[model samples]
Target: MLKLIVNNLKERKIGLHELNSEELTEALHYAVANQDFALQREIGNHFTHIYDQTDEIPYWFKSEYDDDVTIINFGQRDKVVDWSSVTLEDCLPLTHSKHKPLLNGFKNWLLAVSDPLENGGAVIKTSTVKMRVEKVLSLIDAILLRSAALQLSLYHLSHITCDFWLSLFKAMSENGPINGVYDFTGRTVELVKAHVKSITQEQVNAFASKYPFVIRDIAEDDLTLHLAKQERVKACCWLYSQGYYKYGSSFIATGNGAVLAILLFEGKIASPSLNTPTSTELWLTEKERSTEYRPFNTENSKTSTAEATINTYISMAKLINTNIFKDNASSPSIEATKALSVRKINDLVILKPAGRTQTLHPDVVFKLTRQSFEFVLKFQQDILDA
Candidate 1:
């Protein structure tokens, strides 16, 4: 039994027998502080028998002994008592009203049993029982610390649902400290964060309606878009940043007046993509015949139709220039009135648009590329010149 106990403690990195007298005493002090009366009583009994018989106490005792005691008792009178029969309540100091005795009789009893000079009229050598007692005491100390760690793990688990907490508790109890319970908790938290709950199409439509520029040209069939692994990770991080955990989607607004409706999808998806067109492209395409793409109320501007069209072209050019050279140091200046010039290049019209002060890089703004702006402008110009 002692060999088994030593092996168990060694497995946990607790070198009980190897500790010096001072270190062993300190370890015993820690165990006493934790109020593990059951282990204390077991250790006390083992050493008491060793001292009483004047026999050498082995490092480990093989047989088990029944020394169970209830931790509750009240209004006990001071009298001659058998230390062996003393309950946990008898050892505890009277810090509360229920406990009548102010003195810790159990601690006194343990000291007397382990001390060679004090053991009841027994001529037992201190050296004979000291090592055995220290080993047992050290084991008790380790058990107390493990028990506290288990309680702390349970406390953290309490934050989750009761069912989950119970399930985790059972798992820990069965195969505990094998893979750290705390590590298991961290993994559980990550799993919860990655859990993407599905939302109805109605919810998706409502979100799209609120941010038309962000959710532009989303195909009817593509309403249920699945997220890629990288996208899912980003979505999870974004959701956490927003102080939300339930919703697996968000409408990320960009600098260039565009909103991106990001949604997280469950399970693996093959070639997952956001099949949505830009609002600017769609707007430019629809107003190809109009002099200016923007609705020009005659009341809002005194500029002529031709001037408005030129101004609109300039604005589109600036937008495109902004997308292309947004990160470049020596980008061209964007004009407010008109594009620098529009020239025909084979089947395509090359608009020499100036760069804007406020550029929209593709990385900064989701899906707003230089090519997108160029495509819209070229298409619009072709229809107008036709």
Candidate 2:
């Protein structure tokens, strides 16, 4: 049983690019070792919605954002949780009506358990134990499989009393074999014992050190660590689903009087980057990044909370205050505006707050042409030129 517990954690080691601390790693272990439903929820939520900390978000994200974000397909990997292995049907109890916990027993357990997040112990009432167990298992599996990370943490995994966890798994195993529904109980233990090449603390620390998302907060660093990897960004996607900036890619084309910053997300913006060079690098200042935030609505259900998401994003943007955006266009606009001289056409800077929760790039690319450079230099933020 102990081996199974270790293997469950080992299989879902943290990602190399993650910016978590040893405390988080240990906390994750604690969740698995104990039957802490809140911790399990945290693990599941993180896996389903991590963003690429550094990926750029295009300008004018305040516009309507629509994205499906990352789809957690269980079949895609062989992690301990194996989301693909279990189906919704499989999760449903054989006879939910029959197995509902007896009221007195449930109330008794509820009082005994305490959540680390201060959400009060998760209630396993007679009405929801079956579903709750399934949910808990899902959370456990996700963390155990997805922890395949290399992010830094601040604590160490310690030995904890897991008699409750053992019983829970044993019970889940009996309910039609937790093969696909919560198999980590057995597999995770094996992986940890064997010293598999899962995520390492050094890797996680390196990631956080590079991004340093905030002055001294987990949210910002979490964002930064997720982004520095350059690709396969997890943090960015996490934000999109939260409805931060609307997501998409784009093609930049410069004309004589203005620059064309075409949005990849199929939508319309009444006022985009104006023709003025001030619009050239559409960068977001500290104030702007802090102000622009949205809510998460993956299921579009009222149950989804966006406050935690907003705080996380605001914290992250501060870390990448000056993260540079690449110039998409090779040529400059040649048109000249009345107010300013047409000496140069610099790159455009686009600011992305925790813009949205979807698969999106932090910035977009714009091609520069000589004609467009002249246009931007001569033009102003006025409508006549834009």
The top-ranked prediction according to lDDT is 1
> Whole-model Cα lDDT per candidate?
0.31, 0.27
| All candidates: TM-score | 0.14, 0.16
Alpha carbon deviation, residue 214, candidate 2 (Å): 13
Model 2: runs farther than 4 Å from truth?
Answer: 1-90, 93-95, 102-104, 111-229, 232-238, 241-386
TM-score of 1: 0.14
* Candidate 2 worst ten-residue window by lDDT: 150-159
Q: For candidate 1, lDDT tens digit of each residue in 207-282? A: 4454344334545433322343333333334433433332235432321111221221111111112122222221
